[model samples]
Target: MSMNDDDAEILAVARAGFLDEAQEMLRQFEQGLLVLEEDPSDSESLNAAFRAAHTIKGTAGMFGCDAVVSFTHEAETLLEALRSGSRQLDEDVVAALLESRDQIELLLGEVQSGEEDPGVKASSEALAARLRALLGATAAAAHAPAATAPSQAPATGALGEPEDGGGDGCWHLSLRFGHEALRNGLDPLAFLRYLATLGETRALRCQTEAIPNLDELDAEACYLGFELRFDSKAKREDIERVFEFALEDSDVQIFEPGTAPAAFEELATRRCGEDPKARAALFQCWHEMGMRFKVRLEVAAVTAAETEAETPQAIPHIERRVGPAEEGKTQKRSDRRSGEGERREGGRDRRAGDETRFVRVRADKLDKLIDLIGELVIAGSGAQMMAHQEASPLLVEATQRVMDLVQETRDGTLALRMVPIGETFGRFQRVVRDVSKQLGKEVDLVVTGGDTELDKSMVDSIADPLMHLVRNSMDHGLETQEGRIAAGKPPMGRLALNAYHDAGAVVIEVSDDGRGLARERILAKAVERGLIAEGQVLPDHEVWQLIFHAGFSTAEQVTDLSGRGVGMDVVKRNIEALRGSIALSSEVGRGTLTQIRLPLTLAMIDGFLTMVGGVNYVLPLSAVAECIDVPAECAAQNERISGTFDLRGEVLPWLDLARFYGISPDTSRRRSVVVVRDGQTRVGLIVDRLMGEHQTVIKPLSAIFQHLKALAGSTILGSGDVALLLDVSGLLNAAIRNGQQIRQTGTAAFAHAVLKS
Candidate 1:
């Protein structure tokens, strides 16, 4: 039957949920398989692999995703055999399972993206055949060892059935359809049809005493019930799940053949509303299934008012006050009730643990929330400003407290968007394994400090850049095994991805123990491309930076991995777009390390506000070292030196924001220098005024301002003035570049004149 609109919507939601769960299952399977390849005897990993496959298959079956179900079922069978000790986990088996995992991922992706290509079906079938062959070979090998055993008498049942035979396990399921079952679109026969796929239905009995008189009968109402003996190796939960859609309005009682008499008596008591004939039918079915009835189970139904009136813990309290003659019975009853309570509580805890506590919020939603909070911060600043202007101590105090609370809320809200970078790092494991094997190289990927957290948006944005770096390292930095041995290095290559929080920013480092960048080759390539002047002398770091130039590569032979001069420039641009920086360092025969530094969060930051040439600006609080008044002599000689300052005997390079941005300086204002550090490079920013600390909300600048370099973004202040936030790393680079220009000209006047122009 076709689904109604509401049903279709429900099914869509269910499909999305299934896709999410299936993706997680795929990840689990991938990780577990990788682990199993290293240590095949790991029981936990084996169980995890098997469970992931089985769950994917079962859930796909429920969703009617036949392709996924069919393919995963065979893969699950092989995994089960491996898990059960029937099949050994060799490299071949691990490889096959890994392939199966990838196929499952492909199928799920196709389903999620709603793509219907003919090739997917062929691919799925091919994978299924591969899995079947594995399963068949495993089964043959398992039985071969038992074939030479001594002959023994066949064990037989009373009815001449093989006692320990296959497909003999049976579960008796009792289902009574509610009146609303048919109206709610639940067909008991459909469930039965699906059940048959699981196993055989050895026996079936239909209960029909609820049928109304001919004139009173409602045609749409359901009156049928079922008692069936289902033969399958499926667990009770698995069998019960077939009727999931019907369980809300129907009665379902699943019991094994050897269930205690009390269980049956309890079911009978709960069936008090059923017709006498129906009850007798249920009892007869139970008797046929070997249930023996002895003691009567009487359970009094509590009224809504009574249940509400009594406290949950009061019953035990009242039992404790019972007379001595009735104490024993009361104590036993209380103890049993307590035990049941414990079981129920334990079940609830398990459910709680299994249930996902975190919701997957859309990026836009988080951005909107941050935007609203940013507005609130601006409004709070305005209020504080007004309170100060009004000269009211009480008002100022109240506004201060409110602002404090708002700041806390801002922090908590921003923290919600922080996620660990490990998820991004984990994805490279497969890439490393596949690429290394394809290249015939022995490489080990070691990840450390993966728990470092960064803004979720940044993490997502940085993954591609990180991927490029890793692939570049593997393709270029790492040498082949034979080449490694010739260089007196270990035969195996080592690639590491590490992240940590440093100076209020997340630092991610990708390093490899391989042939470092060839300095002469890079310089020669730059010279050939006219990227640098011929015979120009440059520092090793500057030469390395040339690799980020567009269409720059030193590789003589282009390969599939990374030649045709792509990726590195994109990586630099991507990192720059996030207001972050990347630095390259290498030692010729040892290795290369690419380090990226990104803000802890893109939303808001603690900023040290300052003013230059009457324009307000902010420096990241994390990067700010100290603020000091400019020396009288230095201020007088500012135009002479242009960039360098003697700060307590250190020749620190400085940038005058007023001169750099071409804003006329307000000489009447007292000048100050704010020392900021970016990695090992420290620079001083000359400002007209030190405006103290402020909580700054970072609103990204327009694309036009991207080339401005010094202004990272802008924010609003207490007086509603738009303050430009300084890009610390960019400012540092500009200062260094200006200093280099001064050195090249042998005069600060040329640099100062260029800035003025």
Candidate 2:
């Protein structure tokens, strides 16, 4: 084996993945343990635990991870015994298995760091010895997890059996490449092509369903997976051998087609029992046929007869019905691309009107284009003023169309970065599964609105914050099975990570069904920490939010999971730094939902423009609700009312642009107010005039204005003046919450006196 250190390193990475995967599987094993701990007869949980341990042992061997293979070998031995009822899937057994998982994880960490601590060897060996003892004297001598041992002795269960026995029919081997294989500089197709070097293939099919469109595909990623039906007398070992190099890089499923049907039958029969006698055969026959057909056809199964018969039978009808629609859409798309292509080609000539030319720039370049767009917006504002003053409509219109195109380009470019959150959501399943076992809790991650897309930057940044919230929900919001049962709740807890668009921002909510946030605890702690006033009366939702304040912890004991009082505050700050907001709501005994609302992206903010003292201001359009005319007469009625305003039947809280910031007003007779809301707070901004909608290319505020409560960011208006982009929610909240204490006490009594005064 001339496998150099590079090869060893590659193999090591592969082994690491196996260890990681085994750790994941063991976590699943632990969940099964939880179920079996109570009843111990849950067949599904037992099978799951057995399969997980088996996978860990088998996969560890393939990568030459001797420590992992040997340790998991013992775990597998016990899990097999548990499966066979030789030993029960008991609480102690499950705990031992969980401990093994933890040890395996430690071993993996050591492997990652290039060497294991000598202490690890003794501890791991002791754990293996425990597994061997449970394996009994009947177990084979070389009961190691790997086949690489000098003796290829049968494992504990399959003792003394030949490697070639008990499998028939063509085994369809499906392998899905992992990201690591490509990173290891291995060509995945080389593995597949190498498989043919084993023997003649009966049939083969490469599934490209997951292969993203080339335009959307990552060149460095493997999307196509292979399914091969090999015609050979190869044992499961021989069959599994073709993929030895890729054990960690591929999800290998080696099952005989005929065996699948039989196995399906046996399992079904075991569960259904022959109590129904006569109908059992019929049911099983139907089951076998349906199951086999399903496996054969998969979702892509289209019957040959149906295609052959239906094509001619339905062709004329299909042509009559769908011909126009299909042709029309195809033609439209073609024309659009062609027209756009020609314009781009023309623009490449670089003439005065060459602005129409568009090149497909790299995304990074497009980002640069966006930054240049921001600068261009600034320059264009100056150009507009100069052109307008020179009285040139052509120049103005030309500049105006350029502005329009720039806006359109910006929109299209930003849309490119908007990816659905489903990818991030999918990666969390393993996380939930692993963490749930680590804490000895039962939690299932349910995802909703996964198709909701956001900027790539936002998606990358939002993942960890969402994870923390979800983790907090699982570790703290959820309770142990006993606790849940005592609380009259379902034994199993659920944590849902949901994302959806609201207005112009994406809102991600991590909700759990367990014991919700401790409202009283958070309030008491906040008061004790002097983060809030003592005896402060606030909504329960607001109280739950106090957990997010810096240096806050509600955990009775600091476990490995949480209660360090460090997570939530950082989670809040991370979201806020992305120009987002968070809100928490919980019912004392029910559950808690922590929500994060993030702006569409940093590249653009849809803002509503208005004249605040004759100078323009930009308020995020997502936060703005409506605009109303404020008569000059009732204007004074709201002037001294601090920030509260009366609008129709609503006692709307208001922030006067003229007074709040001490900016001088133009003293106009007519006035307008823009009503806005965020989370739970609502505010009205009183302005002198309503300027139309503007695509606010946000320019970061100077350090001097960064701390300003009313302003979020600044942008250049079409009028060639810098307008402050207001944080509507912040303005009104600072006025409302802060003003609540100073609210001229007894507002009703004060109202009469104030009016009379």
Candidate 3:
């Protein structure tokens, strides 16, 4: 493919447009396929698939990629057959169509990989053979039609993906074919066909903007710029890659009717330069992004006619918009350009690597990043150790600077992985809809405060527990239609899923309006089952906590809606495993609210480094309350685990840290007890000294010690020794539950032989 400079540039530009359209069309194909699966009878889905396939044919034809156009034409013909009922929409037809879709993707991939024309023909021929057999079963052959196919489509609902996000946040791309494109064996318009895959091109404007007179126009050169709105899945990269090869010589620009970034103006201003080579490169980046480098004079007029079209007042004003003839520029570009308009091929995972561009790294990779960070922490401790051994101030200062740099790098990496929780919440709407239908109930799920983000892994696991909670609410927490009507409430129930940042933790609430829990009944059942005592006095949340006990359900009869005594206990276990807490609160006739609180991140966290005897320990700062000197009377009861310590008349349970870890304290008098609360269960942890806040990188303990319940995880101290991270929630639960369990276990274990009925 020896293209003359002019033909090469022209072909390159046109190829860009072609690919954009192709991408838009393919997006439609994917979505249409999904829609068809959701609603097989939906005439809309059928028409959508037909239209997308049809559009691909027209665009592919323009590029002279006879193979692509020709095969796509056959597919369109078969889809029309299905639409007209000549060929049934059956397993065979859909399976063939799916295979055809895969073939199209393979063809595009072959071209992208620069494989020979031989590979392309083989694939295209295979697809064409499949499609050829499926075509010819059109409307006339079916002989039964209700609505006639419209002669022409009322321009596809504005170009680019089918989202009705108002305002003109849409785009139009124009790619021109330069002269000599055909002579070089390159089709000047192949890229334009590719663009059709992206979305529907609402309008295809063949620009003669630079076309010379008939005699002056070279036959081998391309001189057309197409204006198109590619409507499809929003893949920005494929469109840019079509002309990626023509960065140095061709003219190209894309326009977006969307909010412009603040830096646009400054960038546009600095873009005024005389270096043609640099200008070309810079312009290529700016142009492909569809960023408006200069404010359009027409914007004011257009906006006046319709407020919807107004460009923001802050838009950058380029001295003059870069046009086809203007030379491009060069300079260091920002990280946002990595996949500016490119799509990942073959479903390969992408990560924020060492490259400057923004990318999404997997959690394991980030954990590796955190692991490297831990090694850095250990290395820092080693340096401090070395400095102390040498006892030199200069060594200490140099080590200090390196530690500071490491701290900054760690913070930066962690920040990169932190994502808002809102994205996770959005998928629940579909979940609620499907679950409600399954349970044969009419429920509307309302969500709020979705912008709160968390660690990506936390977001991933939370979905399951949240799903179980929502399902419980639907099946058991909410009332039936007849039950609701009798109570003077709306027949339709309301379930709300909300998430927000609270204190240093993420608070997620799944609440429902229905009949509240039967507290007296649960208590009676617990006593009879021997899970509780005959007469136990507890708060509402404590009673609710009993619901999370294994095989505990108060439902009278079991059905599919729940009550086989599973799920809630599992939800509790999962939340606890993540170092989070779940609590329940309810009003008799109002509703039930299940709230789960989570740590901001499972990675490195801020901790308060403290010591009891000779061992150093890290306490999660999120759980820290005020530390105070234990009074003489309170300190005297260090051996009694159930005794309450009085602080301003508040009776907080006391647990000596020394005794809990099975280590002896240096001194018992004039010691401090740090009081921490888990829900309403307050306990004081007795320690010898309190250390200020330290950056704690958590390291999990081995499984052998995991059941110890007193220790959560471990971390490294500045002295290069390991210290345990306390399980604040677990220790609190054990302090209360274990005390109750002890009294029952002593009496019941030896006495059960004579009590069995």
Among the numbered candidates, top TM-score falls to: 1
Clash count per candidate: 0, 2, 58
User: Residue 221 of model 1: what lDDT?
Assistant: 89
* Residue-level lDDT tens digits of model 2 in 1-757: 5547666776655555555566567667766765676567788988887677656655554444567656765776677666656664555566677678778778767766778788888999887777666666554232322232232222211122222112223444545676556765556665655444334455566655566777997766777665565544334554454555454455555544343232322322332344333223323233322222211111123355644443332111101122455445434433321213343245334443443663323467767867887776667666766788888999989888877777777788778777898878876765786688888888767889999988888898988888887777788889999999899988889889898888787888888888877677788888889988998786665676677777789789998778889888898878877888888777778888777888888877777888877677888888888998764434766544343455565565555667666677666467777777776556566788887777788888889877676577888765667888877545644554554433543233322322222
Per-residue lDDT of candidate 3, residues 1-757 (tens digit):
4557766676666666667667667766755665575567887878887777756665555555556665665576577677766666765566567566666666655545556567667877877666656554444233211123322222222222222111234454545555655454445455666555444554455655467899897765777655455443333443454454443233445434332322232233333244333333333344444433443222322334343333334333443333332122211121122222232211113322323465434457777978899778768867876997899999999988898898898888877777877766665655665577677787877889887878877888898899888888888888888888999999999999888876578889999998878899899988978988899876675789899999998888897758888988999999988889998889887999999988878878878777888788777887777788876755665554334546787645566677655678878446777866554455667788887777788888888887786576898876778888887877766655565433432223212211111
Candidate 3, poorest ten consecutive residues by summed lDDT: 326-335
Residues 269-369 of candidate 1 have per-residue lDDT tens digits of 55644443334445556555533232321223544455334323111111112245444543343332221335335644665675667665656888899
User: All candidates' lDDT scores?
Assistant: 0.74, 0.64, 0.64
Off by over 4 Å in 2: 1-366, 377-393, 531-534, 631-634, 638-641, 717-720, 739-757
Find the candidate with the highest lDDT and give its number: 1
User: Which is superior by TM-score, 1 or 2?
Assistant: 1
